[model samples]
Each structure stands twice: as structure tokens, then as C-alpha cells.
Target: MDKNLRIGIAVLALVGFGALIYSSNSKQARQIAASATQAPATQASAVGRAIVEVKVPEFEGKAVLGQLAYVAKCASCHGENAVGQVGVAPPLVHKIYEPSHHGDMAFVMAAKNGVRSHHWTFGNMPPVDGITDAEVGTIIAYVRTLQRANGIY
Candidate 1:
């Protein structure tokens, strides 16, 4: 194979192996994730939006718990990666969700009481059925992690 083709195959193989390992060691991994801290968001946007500049966690702690809870609770509307589906829901991986505007509590409350369609045309968001306040927090952490990874804070 050509050099670039060989390199692409290697990258894909590494990613696949990583996913396999991550899933196999999920429980142990979550413990380690607890020690991870949220990367601070500090990018300035001249267009009046906040760019997320936080580092992603290594799949441990609350973020992990949140990831589970999110898969169960929020992923349906928010999309698998919280990137919201077009004509379905708005992406959580966008700039409109700067910490200054959509505080952590907003996510918490939104899970508890649902939210109105203030930003998108996805209509109203009713409260989630089987998640708790604490789960919401962790889920927010997971969402933040995703947003940061996508450069949205």
C-alpha cells in the first residue's frame, strides 16, 4: 500500500483497539476518571460567543457516570455525541452554550424540569423520565467534555 494509505489503516486500527480496551475496562476506568478535572474554558470569541477550550477527561469519574446517564437519558434528542440532530434538536456541541450563558445549573434544571425551545426550532423539551439531579450534573460534565472536545464551551 502507499505510505498514506498504510498510515490511515494504522490510525483506524489504533482507534478500534482503543475503543475495545475502553469498553472492556469501563468500570476500572470510571474510578480513574473521578480524579480528572474539568479543563477551564478560556477562549475569547470576537463574534460574541464563547469558544470552549477545556481538555477532555480520560473517561473516568463523573464524566463516565454522566456518559452512561446521558446515553440513557439525553442522547435520544441530543444525538449520540450531544451534537444534536438537524430538524430534531439543537447540538450541544455549539458555541451558543458558553458557560456564561448556559450555566451548569441550567443543564441540571433542564433534566429535572425540561426546557422550552428558546434557541432552536425543536419545540419544547419536557423533563427526562428516569434520571436524578446528581445524574444530571455528571451528564452535564459529560456534555461539557464533548463540547470542549468539539471546541464549544
Candidate 2:
């Protein structure tokens, strides 16, 4: 083939590849946006009711300790077993909190610095008071365990 023809083919191939990448990325972004807009069940009357049914598997080792810490520190708004609360808080066991999405450090930062509401309409999460970083780690372990069991991972 002529040199110019070869260059033209190469340019076309690159453009095609870039289009493919953009298409894939846009689809993923749309999916994430769709999920984020679909809020969980919320009730005006029930403030702390469980919004989703959570299947809690028996805990062991660090997860056991984590569960206790989560209950003491996070359950009031996040709900029992991290199922979430109606008109109060979002569920930690939800796909939104999966490690690939929210990660462990998100939990730590949210606890330390508070989080602005984006996913749920319940409102902003004020920085949790009187909870140490160590406790937050344990709480993440517990929530992650629950998330995995519930197929969020």
C-alpha cells in the first residue's frame, strides 16, 4: 500500500479504538448515575426503620469486634445490621458502598470529616463524634462483611 494510505488506515484504527473506549466509559457512567438516583425505600413516619432486609451471616474474629463497634457507633442512622434506616440514612450493605465504589478510606473520612449527601435525600452526615479511627476500621470490616454476604461485592 502507499505510505499515505497506510497512515490513513492507522488513523482510522486509532479513532475507532477511542470511540470504543468512550462508548464503554459512557455506558458505565450512565449505569452508575441511574443507580444513584434510585433511592432506597423511605418513610416519612418511620425514622429508623430498616429500609432493606439484610441477611447477617455469623461473624468471626475481627468481624465480630467490628459488628459490635458498628452497632454502637453507626447503627442509629445506618440501621441494624447496616440495612439502613427509612428517612434517616443509606444502607452500608448496598452496592453503592461496595469496596470498588466507596472503598474503606471513604468510611474513615466520612466519620472524621462528615459527608455531604449525594446518593440519598436523607441529608448530610455530620462528622461522627466520639468515634476513634480504630473504631471506624472495625466498623468498615463489619459493614464490608455484611455487604459481601448480601451480594453487594
Q: What's the lDDT for all of these models?
A: 0.68, 0.82
In model 1, the Cα lDDT at residue 27 comes to 51
**Candidate 2: residue pairs that collide:** none
Which one is best on lDDT?
2
Question: Against the true structure, whose TM-score is highest?
Answer: 2
TM-score, each model?
0.60, 0.72
Error of 2 at 92 (Å): 0.6
Clashing pairs in 1: 33-60, 33-61, 34-61, 52-153
**Candidate 1 has what TM-score?**
0.60
Native-to-model Cα distance after best TM-score fit, residue 55 in candidate 1, in Å: 11
